[model samples]
Target chain A: MDAIIFLIFAAAAVIFGINVVLRTHPVSSALALIGVMASLAVIYLLLGAPFLAAVQVLVYAGAIMVLFLFVIMLLNAGSEKKSRGAWMARLAGVPLLVALLTILSFVIFRMYPRSVGVKFGSFAAGTVERVGSALFTTYLLPFEITSLLVLIAILGAVVLGYKELD
Target chain B: MPANFVPPSGVEYIRVLPEIILAAVATLIMVLEPLTPAPRKRALGYLALAGFAGALAGAAAAGWRTGPAFSGMLEVDGFATFFRLLVILAGLLVTLVSFPYLRREEAESGEYYALLLYSVAGQTIMVSAADLIVLFIGLEISSIASYVLAGYMRREKLANEAAAKYFLLGSFATAFLLYGIALIYGATGTTRLNGIAQVLSDPRMAPAGILTGTAVALMLVGFAFKISAAPFQVWAPDVYQGAPSPVAAFLAAGPKAAAFAVLLRVFMTAFAPLTGRWLAIMWSLSLLTMIVGNFAALLQTNIKRLLAYSSIAHAGYVLVAVTAHSEEGVQAAMFYLTVYVFMNIGAFAVVAYFSRKGERYVEIEDLAGLGVRQPVLAALFAVILLSLIGVPPTAGFLGKFYIFQAAVKADLLWLTVLGLLNSAVAAYYYLRLIVIMYMKEPGDSLLELPGMAVSTRAALWTSAAAVVVLGLFPALIR
Candidate 1:
């Protein structure tokens, strides 16, 4: 059952990721990217990384995607024009890409044979409760520091974006 | 493992007192900014100054007890305290320098002071962080605040360009650093410095050489960019050239110092076993940084860009000390940076004052015959320049002397020789400005530099006094 769900989300994620690249208009690409993110979050859940899945949906698919759209709108970016370029990329890109994938697969299979695999709850430690427990104890300093980082980001946006100050 | 989380004790809060004070004061200034009238905005600068002073006192108070805090994320040791105090002082001096510069630019606001305080707060965290995650967050805080501060004068085209380039390139380098940290954690099964050290020292559990080496190389790339070392130093000249003079000063002294502190702690502690592997790399990097920084600086016509390159060369000298990777090397690097903070800040403070309205007079030649117009200010500028040249009776000479001494003890004879020669070449550019200020004929553009304001004079005198006193006493930092 887990494998079936993983396959479905994994396929969806790949198709959406490819759509993101094919779409020229930035907003379209951004929306496709969100689809890719959402699918990936489901895959993370299937892999038993429940906390990571939630964060993927909340931070990446939600907050970060919104940020991407805001930037696209702010810049009023148009669809990318076909470049009078990439001759070398066109010539070597596909063959090099194939060779790269072959090498990567060879390395992965050599490291972990087909018999070596994960069970449904292999990463059971990644439950949201455990993550929350760790966030306040072992990771408390970094968690608190993250608030300061966000504050700085807000202050920077105001300093750069505001029209006038008395 | 315990099922329940352990709440932090009270001492942990005291360990981070300096950062807490700085952040609170900064947030306070932010609240007051909207309430205060326009003419009273300088009062916010005074508030920021008080914040730095209070933070400095807090560092001293916190220094007496040294141990880990907050689950070993921060280590309140001698090294952390020293750098915390140094960065806060750098903030204090930069705030002093910014007072007149902002007023002259007609861009005075509480936000500037707030950002400076927050940036210093970030540096304090950076110097204390024992875990890579905390260090990375602290670095983000400092880098983000500095990026905004670099372009504070939103009206200036140069400031905007400075901020953009710094932001894009800085984020790229940070990604590289984060990858390196992840790789290190994968190899060692931990992000804590001493945990990594234990794993590295245990032969049975040792990480593969290739993995740790690659991680170190990536990290060095990030640190090199932060310190403006060679090959990754292309941004420094341009950013410094365009940034407001005071912000450039703060960037050169504060963030750069904290980055060096992180580099020293990580390399000297966690990666100590791999010294043989990285030592040769540090030697070459040091050589390259010195060669590039000094030779390129000779051609710069803009005074700010020249100092920017000069600072890069100084980073190379400190790198030589780090290449030694000995107790003496850390000591030498510490003393060298302490001296550098003052000398570099003093020089930039002079530039801030001399640049005048809208920063119109940044050319090296524009300093012609300043001795006739303002002898006192020119003399102070000369003192700062001479120290940068590593002349005797100035802190720069002692700093370089100690660094070379450490290099020799470590058998880095060749680097020592090449470094001495590089400093010789560096002297020519620093001297050129001093000579121009005292000898060359004053140009029409050399309108008698406006009477130095009290804040500007305070900035100049304090830094110069630090350079001179540290030069003579030597024991103060040692």
Candidate 2:
């Protein structure tokens, strides 16, 4: 049952990911990206990572997408005029991309043979409880430091956005 | 409760005392910015300086209780202490140098100092980080603050360009680094440096060599870009040229030093078992960085761009020490970076003062006959120039001497010889500035040049004194 759900969502994600890149209008691309994010979250759920799935939807599909939409609207962006492609990229891009995918998959398959398969509950580390335990214990420093990082980002936004200094 | 929270010990709190103080002070500065009134903005700078001083003392206090903290996420050893001290010193010096520039540019604000403090705080975490996740977060904090600082003068087109280019390239490099970290975690199943080392050091416990090698290469690309090493260093000259002078100075010294600390820590510890694979890459990277940094610098007329290239070349020299991968090499890199911070800051301080408003007199020729007008300032700048050229008795000479000595000991004879030759090549541009200062006749550039501010003078004299004093007493650091 999990395998079937994973396959369906994974296929949807791949399709939406392509749509994201291929869309001419920035808003369309952004909307497609949200679709990709939602599908990926469903896929993550199928993989037994409920927490990651929640974050994928809440953060990427929700909050981040809103920001992207704001940027698009503020810019008053229009459909990008398609240029005659870079000749070199047009000629070599697809073949090279295929070659890279082939090599990566070959390496992955070699490292983890088909005899060893994923069992849903066997992947034990992705649960919220385990993550929470780790975050407050061994990972406490990085977890707390992340707040500082957020603070700096806020400070940077204010500095750059504001006009008057003196 | 599913999540059993381990209450952190007092020792862990003390271990990060400096970072805590820096963040607290930075937050306070931001709070006080609007309330303090306009002209009193100078007081904000002093507040930042106080923060840096307190953090320096905090660092010293933290060093006294040296050990792993927060479950080994941060390790406060001598190595961490040295770098932590180095970056805090950088923050303090850069802030001192910034006062005059801000006053001159009529852009004095508390955000500048607050951001500087935050950047230094981030660097403190970076130097002490034992986990890759912490390293990445610290790196982001520093880079974000620096990007904002680079474009601090929102009116300036060049500043905007600098910030945008730096942000884009920096984010790209960081993504590469994150990908590498993910791969490493996949291979070793851990983010802690020592755990990764323990796994990799045992052949039976190690994962596929190809995965580990790829991870190293990606991370090297990331670190190379951060330090502005050759092949990935196209952004440095442009970014430095576009940035405000004092900011350029801070970015060069503080973040670069912290990044180097992370590079050395990660490579020397987690990736030690794979040294055989990476040593050759380091040799070539060192040579290429030196060659590119030197040869490109020769054609530069802009003083800032020239210094930019010089810093890239300096990074190359440090890479040679990394290639050596010995105790002495680490020591050499450490000593080299210490002098590097002082001399580089001193050089930039002179540039900041000379540039006048809007950085008008930034050309190499602007210094013509400076010795005739402001002989004291010119002479101080000359001392810094000589040290940059690696002339003996100066700390720069000792820095290069120690690095080369380590290289020779590690059988990097060719790198040493070539690096010596590169330094010889480097001497030409640095000396050219000195020659123009004394030899040529005074031009129109010096006519409007204002007398030095007290803070600028202090920054100059302190850096110059450090350069000469560290030279005279090598044992102070060595």
Residue lDDT tens for model 2, B21-101? 999999999999989878899999999999999999999999999998888889999999999999999999999999999
| Candidate 2: chain B TM-score against the reference chain B | 0.99
DockQ of each: 0.49, 0.68
Q: Highest TM-score among the candidates is held by which one?
A: 2
- Where does candidate 1 chain B have its weakest 10-residue lDDT segment? B1-10
Q: Write the per-residue lDDT of candidate 1 for residues B338-412, one digit (tens) a residue.
A: 999999899999899988898999999999989888899989999999999999999999999999999999998
Q: TM-score for every candidate vs. truth?
A: 0.93, 0.96
lDDT of 1: 0.91
| Per-candidate iRMSD | 3.0, 2.0
Least accurate 10 contiguous residues by lDDT in model 2 chain B: B1-10
Q: CA lDDT, every prediction?
A: 0.91, 0.92
TM-score of chain B of each: 0.98, 0.99
Worst 10 residues of 1 chain A by lDDT: A107-116
Candidate 2: true interface contacts recovered: 0.86
Our model 2 lands, by Cα RMSD against the true structure, at 2.1
